[model samples]
Target: MRKALTLIGTGLAAALALTACGGSDSTPSADATLDPANPTTITVGATPVPQGRILEFVDENLAKDAGIDLDIKEFTDYQTPNIALSDGSLDANYFQHLAFFDQQVADKGYDFEHGEGIHIEPYAGFSSKHQSVDDIPEGATVAVTNDPGNQPRALKMLEAEGLLAGIEDDSAALTLTDEQNPKGLKFEENQPEILVQLIDDPKVDLAIINGNFILDAGLNTDDAVIVESAENNPYANFLAWKAGDDNPAIAKLEELLHSPDVKKFIEETWPNGDVFPAF
Candidate 1:
């Protein structure tokens, strides 16, 4: 009877152990249905010009193909998109060039990196009062961007027009001293975005405008008296993300962005040659 009681106790213990195991198994864990390979949504930040519109197109088409949803957050200012991306509020951002990205990373000490090149929107010289590039008189006040990156870009544009000649061809560090203006052209340096407002001023003869700012100002690229060539500009746009996110989604995005469909879309949408595909 002692042996039988011992055996019965053992059996009861085993049954209880099985019951506990079953209970633990039946209660679903939080990650039970989660699949990292197939995320449901991807949120990206961008500006409201062509970049945002292009991303919206990519989201609608590419997300559907990949069986994922894309949510795009549009920001007006340059700083907020990177902030959102770093804080995990956005999966990626689509509106900055590699140079600007490098500047941001260096300046803010952020751990972000850029992915594949997207598109190139050439900076151009526009004038509301002057009908042609040659019409500007001597001592005309030309407006340029005061920001470091854009300032050089504006100077380069002036150099390209034969208005300035002292800068070396390959010098990325070229400055205002490059200007060898024969016509005694006066330059006014201000923020690029604000240069558009100067068009209403009679003193400001012409302004060198960045592509994004030009689009933001509701001005047409064809209306620009002088435009940059799209053939070999190195400052094309790119996708930016955290430094270590070697996720498959980023690869997928790059593949789609470089595909022929996007190229065709850009060509057709920007027939005036304002925005050109980098891929």
Candidate 2:
């Protein structure tokens, strides 16, 4: 059984920072001293769907008693969260999976550290016109995300469905070569959020959408023509913070996130397996 927590109103002031990541006007400074006995607020940025929703759950049910307060902020794009975290506009963030995080660290040189997987939102190919993968005709138009981290996953899924080949690795530059695209399928690359809109476009036959956008669009995984398997899925989203910033409140929040209560909440909330607990 999960223990219920008592809410505490600290009234401890949060400091102001310039809007670096399109988030709050004021964020708790990373340099402020945090007392373990009193509740501390940590501003975090996340995508609105499962990531923000999960943090909301922690804030509502778990944070108070554990001496932490989560000031959750929602972001639609993937880049801003890390940008905010690096710029000190946010204390931490919870959105990207390991692959995306690694790529961002490599490209942007963000000194970030992440926790174990909290949950996996499996990548799925959704189509409005085609009922199934078999129904996709020759010379079809497929819409996929243009981001380096996820484009490869979309390509790999296409390869798995026998639609494309010669995907040597998870590379963003990967494209359908002469022999790879046997059916002569056309590819339209766009941002992950934009791919959701392309699903209903008359010109697009299929759109491989990111999991969060799929949920934000209120579409079910059951509607996907081709869905990535959750088993051994490497794309589990987790909490992240800047390296060498050992804020105890951040540690408390991370622990509460992996607690059994969170696991149960995920199971009950997304019962259809739209979201799977990685722990």
Candidate 3:
């Protein structure tokens, strides 16, 4: 992971219709195909930040040494990578965490599996009205990401802050809770991309946003009331591929991605800790 994230608001999106195939090689036998015996390129779909930048680094610095060529296809949204991968448009993808992977499979029944855990994009609760969780008042209007993969995380943060308790299920929505909700908080759920809008909404007391949104909106990490901790975090992003992962090129790519050099790069590149190594 290299760049923090700039494409979220730039109104530029990579065309998902394009094939996952990529750049040519000097060697006549080499191409952007799954030729395990030859130096072949493996195409991967990713979001521009961190994932796309990471791929770029690997392509320039590591993949050639490993006898694997890297083809990076950038996508703007979370769903398109998996969709392109499943349809054979992409050889692999690296953008989402295991929770999102599970949610995608459970919801859409996609035949996919994540290969290696790479990095963590810390989720955070940002608020314009409240400085701390204790500053929140009763009957407050809170907003959360409505995406299936990230909604529960926002509610779990609220649950930890004493607005509610007894969150037995990660998939369960806050509206379905039967436990005591002491704060009587009102929740507003919206698409993750638009969550930054709620920060200025007069009615919103707390707005929980994911890392990508935080980076896009240029919010201060120090301002978050609560941030997702690194210890045993379940939300580490990984490289995902379709079922029956027997590609030799993919194995090489995984090795390069999880290498010590990448770890050092993440720590040094994002010293303020926008992203951290998960492996």
Candidate 4:
């Protein structure tokens, strides 16, 4: 389970950073620090869907109570947040998982640390034509995320569903055949973001999707044919900041993110289980 989650984290990280490779080729940022007591505004970077909404909720409803003035910087993709966080443009970021965090920090030589996990965006499989997993026919073309972090989750889910066998390797080298895939399922691989758009494609039988993308697309989890199990899930996203920089404002924001207000908000807002709280 640990190995699979780690692979999924790295997979999503790569997919998120697809347009541009991480570690360099981006502008450098100055170190971002926050004042604990007089946090007029602490800037944070996050992807637009649930992360932005969750942060907005805290900024609007909770930040003021702890004397925190919240400033949210919406990042469309995964590359910019780490770039911004590293150079100090962002006080923190909350769109990535620990596996992605670990891979990026090590590869990019970034000094970063994450707070307790805030939520788990379960990777799931959705089909517009098929009603259920058992209903999937032979020679069906399945689409999976092409990244390392997310691919394992999809593969593991398929494994759990008795579609494929165990995967020893954790790269994009996976292929579907009758030996491991008795159903004769055909597999197509694409970037995590692109898979969402391919959902309605006539050629695609199943689109393995990220939970955030599902929510962002305004689709509910209840519509999915299969969702990766949440028990011991390793893809939980979290708030991350520079290592050794214990900015009080960042700390306060972290605390508020896991507070009852955020929990209640998530519980009520994502009743379909798209964004499961990991706190």
TM for candidate 2 is: 0.85
Candidate 4: stretches off by over 4 Å: 1-38, 168-184
Which stretch of 10 consecutive residues in model 2 shows the poorest summed lDDT?
Answer: 1-10
**Least lDDT summed over 10 consecutive residues: which range in candidate 3?**
21-30
Model 1 clash tally, residue pairs: 0
Per-model C-alpha RMSD: 18.7, 8.0, 6.8, 7.8
Instruction: List, residue by residue over 93-197, the lDDT tens digit for candidate 1.
Output: 788876667656655566776666789889888887898877988778888766564565666677777776664433332233424666677888875557878
Root-mean-square deviation of candidate 3: 6.8
As for TM-score, the candidate ahead, 2 or 4, is 2
lDDT string, candidate 3, 1-279, tens digits: 232232333222233233332211111222355443566777888877777877888888877767788778877667767777767878888988876778777766676766667888788888888888889888888888777787766666667667777654464454644454666777788777778788878889888887866765677567898787777877888887776656778777877788998988888876777789988
The best-first sequence of candidates by lDDT reads: 2, 4, 3, 1
Best model number under lDDT: 2
Which residue ranges in model 3 land beyond 4 Å of their true spot? 1-38, 178-180
Q: How high is each candidate's TM-score? A: 0.78, 0.85, 0.82, 0.81
Which is better, 1 or 2, measured by TM-score?
A: 2
For residues 42-92, write the lDDT of model 2, one tens digit per residue. Answer: 898888889888988988998877778888877778877877788787888
Which prediction has more favorable TM-score, 2 or 3?
2
Best prediction by TM-score: 2
| Better by lDDT, candidate 4 or 3 | 4
